[model samples]
Target chain A: MQPLRLGLARGWVTWRSVNTTREGLANTIIWNALPLVFLLIFRNATIPGTDISVGVSLLPGMLAMLVVFSVMGTAYYLAAEREDGTLLRAKAVPRGTAAYVVGLLTVAVLDVAAAVAIVLVPGLFIVPGVPLGDAGMWLGLVGYILLGLMACVPLGVLIGSVVRSPRVIGGLGFFGITGLAAISGLFYPIAVLWDWVQWVVQILPLYWLGLGMRSVFLPAEAAALESGGTWNTPLTIGILAAWAVIGFVLGPVLLRRMARRESGAAVAERRRQALQRV
Target chain B: MATTPAGPAIRVGDLRMNYGRHEVLRGVDLEIRRGEVVALLGPNGAGKTTTIEILEGFRTRSAGEVEVLGEDPEHGDERWRAELGVVLQSWRDHATWRVRELLAHLGAYYAPYATASHPRPHPVDDLIATVGLTASANTRVGALSGGQRRRLDVAIGIVGRPSLLFLDEPTAGFDPHARREFHELVHRLVDDDATTVLLTTHDLAEAEILADRILILAGGRIVADGTADALARQVAGRAEVRWRIGEEKFVRPTDDATAFVRDLLTGPDGAGVVDLEVRRTSLEDTYLEMIRRHEHGDAAAAALEPAVAS
Candidate 1:
């Protein structure tokens, strides 16, 4: 709960940075407008399960994917800011680092919240026969979303601490998270993979996030037809929590150490080395 | 926590900093009083910026005692940081933020600023005006010119109303007019607020314009420390008085040019000086001499001795 509260604070600060003025507001509108793109292209595609509309079938997965992408982007932006000294300057402020980190990760919180709102509302109202009304299922959805977002914070800090190039942030960020997600079954089922790949992905959290979302949103009949006919709810929650725990416990320590070691001079030296290499 | 004001505004004694085996700063001693604008003048890799960053609590010293605003900068906290301001060379781009609005947000971070009189959050307005950014106050940082951006950097640095400011090559990309204007603002800021300034610059003219005292660092040591004019005299030695007398141009060292001119010109008839120009040593000439002397020792002395005597 404390971790959630801290994450909430981070989310709120990112919101504040974005909403501080009209430009920020516009940026959010542009970012949140992503669902509109989904509506235009894949909104009418054939359903994945049963005879359900593709818009309805892909909605949950799209929501989960958007949340993951937004969360990862927030994490990477923070890493970039830290690399560029903005994070260090924020650390020098009164509350020290925890507050500042939460502030940067705040963007992801807004992203995930907007994504969840946009995903659920449309699936609930516009799409016919989209599942709802199971209290346990709703609980599962909230749990995974919250847990998934929590995991992003530490990963964001880790990526920020390790990646030094401001320009490479996008490449490193997309490749790292998307590559991990590809095997984890966030966008598609792991059952489509080779036996060796399935075994490998079973060890990842996104597989559980995707699995957890499917178990909650899909009709129980559809869920029952695949993957042992039961949601790995406990396993999904536990793995996500573990990632969050590792992120929380180690993230700050790593960030502080990285900040202490890195400086403007370090960046200049790295640039010199890069030039020499070239 | 103790606020008796006993220690200097900035102090670094025997400070040594290194990256790997390459020592950047070695045995550097520095002291800056409150309200004093001390300039660190040196060539690139001369450890000027390193010393300033260490004092600003942005960099850790490998060895030495550094007390900034009566606190150990290496172990400084938020309160210590609040007492000082730093103008970094550049800023990151935020696509949507206007300049004034951005400064206002940064000002809100300080504890003192959470008040009533600055109700609308116009703290940075005067600083914006101070740095000559009134026209660009509404401009986004992304849209600003290099000189304008640097000015905004200065405005942001001083927005906290800090008692001490660390400026690392503040006027680097500024034009001549902008640079001169910045110096005036600096002088006024120092006078009005007693804001202790520690500036690092490659430009000697900028140092001479803004610094009350200058420290020339080389090989991570303070090779010369004095007021700009004083440093020039101390390093490059006496002025040379040259006069065109008849066919030959005669050059002689003079401690008192007024008295020397009377003896050289009026003492003898037809030995009257035609083209007499008294030249004093410049900060640039002295700085080069000091840095060269620090590196080459006696070899430097041999070259500079005859040049100074003439």
Candidate 2:
């Protein structure tokens, strides 16, 4: 319980630092710029069978994208921490890693919240009738966002634990998530892709996250644009919950293994390798 | 016997560490009493860092019986770890945190471990003042200068008010003034809190000034162990004695300088004696000679017969 409380404090401190820092705030804005512009440019463009503008339909997908970015952010931070002596410091404290993990998760949640607010605030003006007045709409939005985070953040930590360097997260991690987004129907409809590709994308959490987001914002008829011509709410919840459960199980083990190997010598070796690279 | 229930703060028996086929530490054994400040002095690659890490439970050893705070370090639980303070060589890790904020955050971890007699974490302001970082309390960690940063590292290590502290080259990059300040802070910890300290350094003067006992590690073993003065005496028993009889100077090296001086002063020529001087070997000389001897095939001989401080 004490570890948990301290972890929350750590998270709160880190969140404030990240958001208040000029570079950190600028980085978040710059990352969302491309997607925001993409939606604005295609605002008048309709989604073929529907009268809704492409901009409004893309908002839910952008929310999904926002959550996915948190995963990348968590992984990048972990890699950077490993390179520095931050992780080893955590290892030295009693139950420090447990608190560190909790702190990291807290940071991820707040980060995702900030990302959503950045998009959603401007989104309300550009996109019409976002169902803001409806209680059900708010529930869907909150539920999907929570479930989506639960699904992605742990997997990101798992990847971060295995991968040695931040460069890998940038090169392999960024490209890999972007590729999933491309097929998961975030920017475009999945029906346009090959059936097998759609199946592969659906196996991932991003697709269901995007779908869940669309269920909350898009009108009832928007379900027609989905692959099965329905919300598939049960499957979305099931799959996302399954990912969360699996992540909760595997994430700790992998993180522990990664942390157990961290020592002062290891950090020095990494620092040496980093210097040579430069 | 009214001794403290807690056993020796640290004890190692036949500690050996190997990486692949290369052996780093070979059959090292030592014990440190509570509140004692011991300096592990050795050249680079002498396994000072390795020995400290194994005790901190950060690395696994090939073979050894190591106990810290009365528990085997390899299996020490979280409660056991709460009693240890470790100061590691740090790069820029918490670059964005404010000095006071970071200390407070770390201090929270020890809140639950607090006992009536021993409060777990030191108050943030007091710790900052103790380490001479009170002026930089609000500054971002990244903005701190190198000396200030090292001081912060020390502050963080002691935030928990650990009973046993491990410092591996804590003042590696410190200037002379900062080094002196650091030494003072360590004395304060030992004097006020009764914290046991095991530090490693290449600075012989530091060992001489800070350690109650100094252990010279080489060839994967402790070649010499004792107080700084004892080490010097053990390594080189002879002291140079110089005297002048009626402007004619004479010098001789003798194992017993007192007897030699007494005889000379009382002898027939004693009346003319002047400018008498006896110089014992410095720790610097003793350390070098010990390392030189160990490097010159005497390591195996020393390893077979370990030196335990009496």
Candidate 3:
């Protein structure tokens, strides 16, 4: 219980430190605004053979993209912190690792929320046919975001623990998430891709998250454009929940293994290698 | 809490560590009592860091019976961790965090472990002042100078008011002024909290000033263990006595400097003797001699023994 309280305090302090800085603010605005600019450019363009504008369809996909990016960002931070000795610092204290994990999770959630809101607020006014007054739409939005975080945060931890280099996550990870997005149908429909590609994408969390978002944001008529030609709410829920359960179970084991290997010698050797690269 | 465990703060017997075929620690043994400031001095790759890491429970030894604060470090729990403070060499962790903010956050973890006799955390502002970072209390850690950063590291290490502290090369990169202040800080921690410190350093002078006892580790074993004076005596067991008779100078090494000086003075040249001086072997000289003997596979290395007076 004490560790939890301290963790909460740690989370708030870390979040405030990153968000309040000038460089942090600038970074947030630039990355989040890219998706918005794309949405605006396609505001008037309608989906093929449908009365729905591409902008409205792209909004939900953009939100899904933000969710996926949150996972990658979280993973990157974990790896970076390990390299910089922050994780070891936590280990040095009593229950400090628990606090450190809680702090990181808090930051990830807050980051996703802020990024989503930045695009959503302006998106509401710019796009058309969104059910602004529908309580169901709002509830679904909140539910999907919560589920998405639960599913993705653990995966982030697992990846961060497994990967030795933060640069690998920062460099290759960006392209990997972007590539996953391309196939997951965030920008276009998944049905248009090859059958095997669609099957592979369906197994991953990104496609399910995008589907969940589109089901709530787009009108009921828009379901025809989906791969199954209908909104399979149960399948979406089951797939995302499966990911969440799997990640929660495996994440801690890998994290503990990685942490057990951490010592001053390891950190110093890493620092020496990092400096050599520079 | 009143009935604290009655034993040495740390005890290790026949500690051995091997990285595959490479043996780092081979049959190392030492003991540190409560409130004792012991310094581990060794050349690079003598398994100093490995030995400390094993004691801190950060690494596992291949074979040994090790105890820290009465429990085997291999199985020490969070309560055990709360009682220990580790001051690692910092590179760039918590860089964005302010000095005061980081300290306060870390100190909160110890609140539950606080006892009547030993308070959990030293106060944030007071800790800041103790490490001489009060001016940069609110400053970002990344913005601090090298010396200031190390000061913050020490502040963070002791923030929990630990009973036992581990400092691995605490003043490695420090300048003279910073080193002096750091030595003073260690003294204050020991005097105020009775914190038993186990620090590893290559700086012999530092070991001499801060350590209640010094242990010189060479060839994976404690070649010498005792006070600085005792270790120096083990290596040479003689002091140099010098005197000038007119324009001529005389130098002699003897087991009893007092007797040698007395004999010289009472002899024919007693009245003529000028600029008389006596110098015992410095710890640096003793350390170098021990290391050299050990490297050359000399049997005398084992003869140095503990030399610690009971």
Better-scoring candidate (lDDT), 2 or 3: 3
The DockQ score of candidate 2 comes to 0.56
Model 2 stretches with alpha carbons more than 4 Å out: B1-6, B238-280, B293-298, B302-310
* lDDT digits (tens) for residues B45-118 of candidate 3: 88899999999999989998999998888888898999889988655888788889999999988888898977
What does the lDDT read for residue B106 in candidate 3? Answer: 91
lDDT of 3: 0.87
At residue A13, give the lDDT of candidate 1.
48
lDDT (C-alpha) at residue B234 in model 3: 72
Give the higher-TM-score candidate: 1 or 2: 2
Pairwise DockQ winner, candidates 1 and 2: 2
TM-score of chain A of each: 0.77, 0.96, 0.97
Q: How well is candidate 1 docked (DockQ)?
A: 0.29
DockQ of each: 0.29, 0.56, 0.68
Runs in model 3 lying further than 4 Å from the true structure: B1-3, B236-279, B297-310
Tell me the alpha-carbon RMSD of every candidate: 4.6, 4.4, 3.3
How much is the lDDT of residue B33 in candidate 1? 85
Scored by lDDT, model 2 comes in at 0.86
